[model samples]
Target: MQTIWAPWRITYILGEKEQGCFLCQKARQVEHDEENFVLCRKTHAFVLMNVYPYNNGHLMIAPYAHVSSLTELHHDQLEDMFRLAQLCESVLTLVMQPEGFNIGINLGKVAGAGVEDHLHLHIVPRWNGDTNYMTTIADTRIIPQQLEETCELLRSGFLLEQKER
Candidate 1:
């Protein structure tokens, strides 16, 4: 497998355990939603806008627990993760109206997980013709929307729906 190692990932790998856990930290700091690009927080997981996305409105839903493998998670955690993923898809569709999405988890380090300490599902909003010559020819992916705007749209949509419930 071809590994793409970025300089920032080193921090995740070498971080102290006393920091508790990164995923848990995000879960705990609920008030930092806007700054953190966190759209919604469910019982077992949360959805956040991807700061660096393959496309606009790209997001990720992850378990609150800091587990590396899917099998290591409890049934409730797995269920909630999928539930959040489903809701994330709905919110993205409602707000961005994308043609489709790329939703799944990269299980391990070799499989392109930037945070190997936690398992998260990437919900990447996609569109027809979104991939262009830039990616193939220029080796670059263009995201048309800002992360803050995407997060605001998703967060408002999610909060509105929550109010309905």
Candidate 2:
């Protein structure tokens, strides 16, 4: 039998899943900025690094409102989500230098929404040869960077964007 060790995933395996909406809680709680991995917070929406990511710079932009459906959001909230999504794209390009990206919104559980109770957009960075033996053969992904490093790297990009404005 082939054995692969992913010690980092042990924390996730043993950790307790929190009650309530994790995204909503993270949106309001700024106390644990780095712990929460929040890169940038806007009026109606915020950009945060995915604790569990498909790629290094994976991010999600969500509105502060608790509404799940896209139609339930106010016009400005929808606008903020899009604005932040665009910012996430630029940030990923600058920090990760990915060849491409996969950006989308999963509305319902049936539609692959991890947090179906809150609406958000997922931005997954991709590269030409990012896929390798680990993902293809071992059925696991190896993120080359830690979450903190990713957050800090993307945060710098966001800060640079702010300065340019």
Candidate 3:
């Protein structure tokens, strides 16, 4: 038999889950912006890098209101969330040069939401053959760039857009 030693997963597998809502906690603490991996912040929403990403430059945009269901959000909230998603798409394109993208929201726990209470839209950049043997056989993904470096690039791109606007 063959084995893949993904020791880093043990932290997620056995680590004590954080209490309360991380999105809410991170949103309120501007002091820990870097530690929280927040790439950009607007009035209604913020973009955060996925701690466990499907690919390089993966991000999630969430409303600061701490709402779960999409219907709970006001029209302005929805508008801002999508605007941020579009901005994220551009930033990812410029920074990662991904051929495509997969963007969506997983509503509840049964719907595959890791953090079910706080609604978030995932922005996963896709490339040709981004999935391969590691995914099918070993259940692992290969991300080419460091999270912080990708965050910096995307953050810079995001800020540049704001400045130009």
Candidate 4:
């Protein structure tokens, strides 16, 4: 197996444990969409670009209320969460159409929920050979574009569409 280098993972090393709820913290902060990478905010849910994306335009639609279990969400929140996910796909198709996608939620710690306190639906854009030898053999992921660039592009489209409407 060839060794693959991914320098970006270092950004997550220090202070990761000290960090609290990312979704709540970002929503409370003073920043533009490009800074926060927030796409849309609904009554019960909101969409945001993944700070660490599996691909260039990866996104997550999450309920505002922090809950680990799928059954823990109020009916309206669950509906709005999936609805926002659909909207995310719609926007991604319009702006950054990939060949395919990976969408799901991991409910618990063992199930791979990085933030088990809050539920977020992941929308990962996929293409042929996306899961190549690097992931399986080398334990690395090669994402071509920077998260900030992707954030800027998505936020621009979202803001433009909002203004048009």
By TM-score, how accurate is candidate 3?
Answer: 0.90
What is candidate 2's lDDT per residue for 1-165, written digit by digit as tens? Answer: 877666767888999978899988998898887788888888899888888899889898889899889899998999889988888888788877889999999999999998899988999999998889888877788888878777788889999987876
The model with the greater TM-score, 3 or 4, is 3
Per-model lDDT: 0.79, 0.87, 0.88, 0.79
| RMSD of each predicted structure | 5.9, 1.5, 2.0, 2.6
What lDDT tens digits, residue by residue, belong to model 3 across residues 1-165? 867565657878998887899999888988889878998888899999998999888899999999999999999989989999989998888777899999999999999999889999999999999898988977788777677788788888988877876
Which regions in candidate 4 have their CA more than 4 angstroms from the true location? 1-10, 14-18, 30-33, 160-165
Model 3 residue runs over 4 Å out of place are 1-16
Give Cα distance to truth, residue 5, candidate 4, Å: 5.7
Best by TM-score: 2
Name the Cα RMSD for model 4.
2.6
Which candidate ranks first by lDDT, i.e. highest?
3
* Clash count in backbone of candidate 3: 0
What would the per-residue lDDT of candidate 1 be over residues 1-165, giving only the tens digit for each residue? Answer: 544344544654796554555566777888887776788877888887766678888788888887899999999999999988778877788888988889888987899988888888898888899999879976867666556666778877787667766
Which pairs clash (backbone N, Cα, C closer than 3 Å) in model 2?
none
Q: List clashing residue pairs in candidate 1.
A: none
